[model samples]
Target: MAKFRKKPVVIEAVQYEFGMEDGFVVDGRYYDKSGPVPRAMNRIPAIKTLEGRHEISKGDWIITGIQGERYPCKPDIFAATYEAVE
Candidate 1:
């Protein structure tokens, strides 16, 4: 008998809401939208650490933390309102 292996899926981009708990909502979601806003808060900051364990720049591909997991998202699907972690 032979075993079958599944291929890895690829994502482009995703919309993310940065905040503590469930306060800031984006795309029908919520993040820590309450509290003192950071002085150096970047709505769409560059990716400092990710699955690659490296810095991510604009035009790069990424996914969203949905339901406590990273899901695949196409550039077009998320490009509309994709924000990096700050």
Candidate 2:
């Protein structure tokens, strides 16, 4: 067995919130914003990742990976995994 530690990397992220426009931009790319109907009929917040469309829940963090791919990460996990650079 071999052990390897994850290399530290700084990434760009934005917290998904209510009322953002459909064509809102993050990390220089535009993403469609949608979610529950209660938020004025916006589609479920999501991003097109390497795997597929991933839903972005309210309070979820949208993270841009090293290669510029974007995806959603739960707040709890994100808090435990990442920290503000400054």
Specify the highest-lDDT model's number: 2
What is the per-residue lDDT of model 2 for residues 20-56, given as tens digits with 9 covering 90 to 100?
3243344434456453233234445556779876666
Task: Tell me the deviation in Å of residue 15 in model 2.
Answer: 0.4
In the range 1-79, model 1's lDDT, one tens digit per residue, is: 9999745344334344332122322343223334543344333222323442222334445454433444334466556
Question: Where does candidate 1 have its weakest 10-residue lDDT segment?
Answer: 17-26
Query: Could you tell me the TM-score of candidate 1?
Result: 0.24
Candidate 2: clashing pairs of residues:
34-43, 34-44, 34-45, 35-42, 35-43, 35-44
Stretches > 4 Å off in candidate 1: 1-3, 7-12, 15-53, 65-86
lDDT, each prediction? 0.39, 0.71
